[model samples]
Target: MTVKDRIVEIIAEQAVLDVSDVTMDSTLEDLGIDSLGLVESIFAIEEAFDIQVPFNANDPTESDFDISSVASIIKAVEDLVKAQS
Candidate 1:
């Protein structure tokens, strides 16, 4: 699956929803995912792509990575993967 597809799956799993329920505009809060779920989702994404995510658990707003929406997250991950390549 593509990176975007895999990310949607991860986020869906974390939110306890079907993949179809996740959209590019969906935010973690919109999906009812808490901070723990967010962290878990981030970990899963990092593992899936084998890339480190620059996220701060204590203060997510302080992190450089954007977690505002699924679309933004996808873009960030794609950029990271491209940078790695």
Candidate 2:
């Protein structure tokens, strides 16, 4: 699966929703996912890509990573993956 697809998958899994429910414009709250679910999704993303996500679970707003929407998250991870190469 592509990075975006994988990201949506992880988020959907954490939120206990179907992949079809996850859209690029959808935010975590839109999926009815809580803070813990966001953290878990981040962990899953990190593990899946073998890349450390620059996210601060304690203070999400303080982090440079953007979790505002699925599309933004996918863009960030795609950038990180490219940087690793």
Candidate 3:
């Protein structure tokens, strides 16, 4: 699957929402993803892509590193993928 597809699946599984409900512009809060859910989703994404997300789980808001929107998350993942390549 593509990075975007993987991200959508991770969010869907973690947030317990349908994939159709999530879009590039959908925010985590819009998808009903709480703090714990966001952490879980990040972990899932890390595992799926075998890459570390540059955010502190303990303080998601610190340094504005937390990904609030699907588009931002996808962009971050794409950057990581590109860096690895």
Top-scoring candidate (TM-score): 1
Cα RMSD (angstroms) for every candidate in the order listed: 0.7, 0.8, 1.6
lDDT of 3 by residue, 1-84 (tens): 899998999998877889988888999998989878888888888899898788887766673344868998998888987888
**Clashes per model (N, Cα, C within 3 A):** 0, 0, 0
Put down candidate 2 lDDT per residue, 21-82, tens digits, no spaces. Answer: 89889989999989888888988999999998999888888888988999999999999999
Each candidate's TM vs. the true structure?
0.96, 0.95, 0.88
Q: Model 1 — which ten-residue stretch has the worst lDDT?
A: 56-65
Instruction: Show model 1 residue runs off by greater than 4 Å.
Output: none
Best by lDDT: 1
Candidate 1 TM-score versus the reference:
0.96
| Pairwise lDDT winner, candidates 1 and 2 | 1
Model 2's TM-score against the true structure: 0.95
Clash pairs for candidate 2: none
- For residue 45, model 2's alpha carbon misses the true position, in angstroms, by 0.4
C-alpha RMSD (angstroms) for model 3: 1.6
- Model 1 clashing residue pairs (backbone): none
